[model samples]
Target: MIIQMEGISKSFSGNQVLKEVAFSLEKGEIHALMGENGAGKSTMMKILTGIYARDSGTVEVKGKQVVYKGPKDAERDGIAVIHQELNILPELTVAENLYLGNEQTVGKTAWLKTKEMNRKTEETLRDLGLHVKATERAGNLSVGKQQMIEIAKALMTNADVIIMDEPTAALTDREIQTLFKTIRGLQEKGVSFIYISHRMEEIFSLCDRITVLRDGQYVGVKNIPETSFDEIVSMMVGRQLGGRFPELTNEPGDVKLEVKGLTRMGEFKDISFAVKSGEILGISGLMGAGRSEVVETLFGYRKAESGQILINGKEVQISSPIEAIRNGLGLITEDRKTKGLITDFSIRENISLANLKSISTNGWIAKKKESALFENLIKRLRVVCSSPEQQAKSLSGGNQQKVVIAKWLGTSPSILILDEPTRGVDVGAKKEIYTIMKELAEQGVAIIMVSSELPEVIGMSSRVMVMFEGQMKTILDRNELSEEHIMHYATGGDKHVG
Candidate 1:
């Protein structure tokens, strides 16, 4: 085995995050670590990467037991990690960022060998199938491209054990395929990986073994060929999930939101849609099909050159997020880390962020009232945390997303827009979110959901609106929605609606 962790245990402020978790990886193997949010998968990886010291147990790398004082120590011992959050310095050029701590120096002068670094970075980028130039500023690249740079940085270490956390979250299909190919190539050279992701298909297709963790305890491990999808899910969630989506029980009512000729120049053009109270209107399309742009415009993040927005049969101008909120509209943005929650703030602060006015009096916050409100929201949303005072960044990705939802829910908006609501969430958490949406819809909240996952859109939406190149291609009823039809319209093919 290249790496083996036995009886690994850890805790934080009386909250046990891991309990006797055992994991192993063979040389050249891609091992999957599966768990719901706060399930200790990330915690275990942090321990192995030397970000946190394990409270108990043993970690052996390459048949030798050694204790790493920090990430530098781990790296020195042939280990590297690509965190879920990008850690590159955006201000630096790609080549400079890649060689950050280990710059090549010229002949005892301590001068940087800039040309040599750039040459090597260019070679690494090309080998990783990235088109980005080594001299390009890291901040200017797209999130997907930046992710590739992170991979390249890890590979530059020549580490035998690489830990990846949700590495494909921001990648397109082509980029994902390229990444898998790269992994396969590296595996042939005896480089092993400990992979973590919420996407089950990726786990099955790319991993050799699966390890399940639940509520900070080790569940079990199975070889990919010997285990079924259902079995792995049951292990992670601690129960059997009956279906992919919750049953929709709400029926459509009067139109709660209406848009006409919404245009934003090159972004989207002449788009129009109506979402009725108690109905889920799903917007589906390719990644760059302007779905997020349209929703952002509606939420007042972008200005629409010419358009009409009608809420409850009355035309209104929402030129800012405050106006949108005052008009009973809420938006859960696509990038949760950047747009949704304030990572450094407490959960209580984030929940009240959207509706501070309601919980305040005469420009002063009502402390008791605020605490009560946040406590209620935290319980209702099932945001698992040590306390409401816990920093938002300390929670798992799923819990962080729930806090975003709770923040918007606190506003009590009549129309709620969720863009890529379950992008990086686990399957169990996805179901919980679906249930929350259903309950909200049942209470007469009009929902407009934008999702790239076809199955989610088909299962939860009352009607699916397909967009292509900033144009509204067609709208399909539930019966007419299919992966093939959605892709056809998304790719500028003929619109077919039943």
Candidate 2:
């Protein structure tokens, strides 16, 4: 075994998070760690990477029991972990980030070797089958490119073991294929990898072995070729999933939104669509195809050069989100952490922010009414919390998205736009959200869903709209929504009218 963790135990405040967890890995093999949220997967990885001191455990690397104090110690021992939460300096270039630790020499800092670093970074990117410039600012890159950079950082370290948590959560299917190829290449070169994910398809595709952890305990480990998706999911949830999705039978109502000639130069042009009550319309496109920009303009966050928006067949000017909301429009932004919710505010405060006018009397917030609203939404959305006073930042990604949806629900908008509604969420949470969305639509709300996941867009959208190079391609009905057809439209290979 290249690595072995035996009898690992950890806890906080007398609550055990990991109990007697055991795991092992070998060279040239991809080991998968499967678990639910707060099931101690992150905790186990933290202990392995020296982020936390294990309560009682023995870690043997290549048959040698070692002691580590911190991340630097782990790094020196050839262990690297790419955390789920991105940790990149926004202002730093890719080359700078790659060589950040090696910036200074033993004696003094020399004239910062820019050319050598650039050359090495370029070489690394090509090696990983990615085409990112080294001098470009890390913050300017898309989430997929940023993820490639993180992987490059690990490769540059020449670490023996690379631990990745939800690596494909941000990448496209093609990018994920490239990543898997790179992982195989590295594995052949004797670098072992530990992959963690809730997606069983990805696991069966990439991993050699699977380890199931539930409720801080090891359920079992199985070979990929021998295990089935049903087996894995049952082990994780401790039962068979009743149904992947809930029954949604909502009748169509009158059109609540109409957009015509929506154009944003260099982003999207001449985009026209209408969403009716009790309908979920999905918008899909390749990265940089302007799906987000179109939605942003429709929501009044970006200016549309030549467009006419009408709510209920009446022309209206929507210069800002406030105006849009007043005209019965609500938007759940793509980047939830930045644009969806206020991370610093309490759950109640965030949930009630959109309808503050309704909850205020004479410019004074009605505290009691606000409390009732908070409690109501929390219950309605099934937000996992002990009280409404919990900070929004304290919840998980899925719960945060629920809070954002609840916030928009407060205003009672007739049309709701959810951009990447299930982005960065677990499968269980994704199903939960889909149920909520279906329920909302069944209640006569118009929904516009923008998603990059092909399966998700096809599964949830009653109709799918494809965009390529800032132009809307053919709008497809649910029956015509196949992965190949969607990809063709998304890649501008299909006939279209701008």
RMSD of each: 2.8, 2.9
TM for every model, in the order presented, reads 0.90, 0.91
Q: C-alpha displacement of 460 in model 2, angstroms? A: 0.6
lDDT of each: 0.88, 0.82
1-498 per-residue lDDT for model 1 (tens digits)? 889899999988877889999999999999999999888988899899788999999999999997888999999988999988778788999999899898899988889999999999999888767767789999877565788889889988989889999888766444677789989989999999999998888899999999999989999999999999899999999899988788887678999999999999988999998999999999987656788889999999899999899999899999989889989999998778778989999988888888788899998999988988888888887888878788998888878889999889888889999987887789888888899899999999999998866778888999999999899999888888888888788878875433
Poorest 10 consecutive residues of model 1 by lDDT? 169-178
Name the lDDT value of residue 110 in candidate 1.
88
Q: Counting only residues 3 or more apart in sequence or on different chains, how many pairs clash (N, Cα, C under 3 Å) in candidate 1?
A: 0
| RMSD (CA, angstroms), candidate 2 | 2.9
RMSD of model 1 against the true structure: 2.8
Off by over 4 Å in 2: 104-108, 126-132, 379-382, 496-498
Displacement of the residue 436 alpha carbon in candidate 2, Å: 0.6
